[model samples]
Target: MSAAPQMNAQHINAITNAAVIIVKEHLGMQTGFSKPYVSGSQFMSSDISVVMGVNGTLEGQIICTMKNQTALSIVGSMMGGMKVETLDEMGWSAIQEFGNWVAGRAASELAKAEAAIDISPPVINEGRSTFRVEKTFLTIPLTSEAGEVLLHVSITPRVNE
Candidate 1:
């Protein structure tokens, strides 16, 4: 088997830290980020996942996965106490926006290392799905009172000098 890619500790740390900060600031919820690790894009346990692309200094994708119920709870909170029970069009839109917000913030934080990165608009998907990637990915698992949010980050650094 081919060896997994080696990620810069600083880069991974920046992404993880940015996720924690954005979730708290944007959602008003405390979140915990697990140490990032390199792995294939395995199917997530969650029913809903928001996927976004990373381009520019790094090229890859970012996926924000969460359970359906958890997605509802988060959307509800974002709506300021409104109840959300289903993954309808509105729910999907909210999730995509949330994913965008997180990814944008993360890319900005990553750019602090002088690596210019930009995130693509989010695509929301429901149920279980499989992802295939040749390069190993940096996966960050985030936990909150609502539920778990898995951040599947895959990137290839560009040569900038």
Candidate 2:
């Protein structure tokens, strides 16, 4: 196994700030973040999660997790206050787009700190699941009027080839 690359504080800050900004600006919800904590071996995800991969200066995943009701509420807010009783195809697509916005903002923030990075398209995961990785994850729980969303971040400096 490769040695674990050091995770920079700037990178973490950039990602968390990006998430908070997106929630506030796009979702129109004020948010507060709890202290970040590290999870070993695995993370038990919520009912719904949007996972995106990061590469370039940093490598790993950024997962946005929340309960099903929270997801529906968020989608509803995104759709101009339309009530979303269920997650239809359009709702799922909106959720994915939300993830894309977060990732894109994170990339922009990282770049401002001179950390060039690329992010993959978001993948939505429904139902509760356990995510295991050799690398540890730093989870930040963001509390908002809509609900609590957990941001699971596992990123490290890229190893030189």
Candidate 3:
């Protein structure tokens, strides 16, 4: 096995920008992100989380976490202001589609910097949970009108044997 690939400033910027753009474009809400920091192999998620795997040039996971209310608010906005008190099956599917939008946007942004990547289908986790991995993650907290959404990015270059 080889050492994990280090994510540089450019990669981090691309990811952060992608998240911000997605929130603004899809949810029609502006988002401001805080300073990104590195985390250990374990991540404590919030009430709801959307986890997706990254492959191709990069490998790892990107997780979007937020409070249950926040999830409802986002789903509401995605559904054109329909009030969402609970996450029904359709609401849950909307949340997953939100993750897909972020992942697709991230891939596009990374490709602009010459990094081709593929994102897996998103998996939604309801309730708090801890995600453990072998590689460190770069976490960025994005604040918007709906609420605070944490974007946990753990990615490294895929080494070819």
Candidate 4:
């Protein structure tokens, strides 16, 4: 197996900032930034997680985790008052789309830092799955009227870099 990519200070700052900006703009809420930390895998165990793999200048995964109520409330508000008591298929889809949108925005913002990234489709994990980070990650807490959600972002400069 190959070693993980190294993330410079600039890359880290850009990625973290992009994540916070995208989430706050999309959800229209206040977000809190957390200091980046290293964990021996299992960075998070959440009720639901929307994960997407990224490639290009940066490589790693971006995960969005939240509780059932948080998901419902956010999706409900996004869809214009659509009731969301539980996470049905439609709810899952909504969350997936939101993750993709956020990642896309982050990628766009990364461009300003000369970092080109490509995000894959989001994979939904509903209360069952153990995702290993296998590298240092940054977690940012976003609070809204609904509840608190965490963004687990792990990206490193590509090997060629």
**Which candidate gets the maximum TM-score versus the true structure?**
2
Sort the candidates on TM-score, descending order: 2, 3, 1, 4
Mind sharing the TM-score for model 3? 0.95
Badly placed stretches (over 4 Å) of model 4 are 1-4, 34-36
Q: Candidate 3 on 44-126: residue-level lDDT in tens? A: 99999999999998888899999999999999999998999999999999999989998999999999888899999999998
Clashing pairs in 1: none
lDDT of 1 at 45: 39
lDDT, each prediction: 0.77, 0.92, 0.90, 0.76
Ranking by lDDT: 2, 3, 1, 4
| Candidate 2 Cα errors over 4 Å, as ranges | 1-3
lDDT of 2 at 160: 83
> What is the TM-score of each predicted model, taking all chains together?
0.87, 0.96, 0.95, 0.84
Off by over 4 Å in 3: none
- Candidate 2 RMSD computed on C-alpha atoms after optimal superposition onto the true structure: 1.3
Better candidate by lDDT, 2 or 3: 2
For model 1, what is the alpha-carbon lDDT of residue 119? 84
* Least well predicted 10-residue stretch by lDDT in candidate 3: 1-10
Model 4 residue 107 lDDT? 86
Clashes of each: 0, 0, 0, 0
Q: Quick one: best lDDT, which candidate?
A: 2
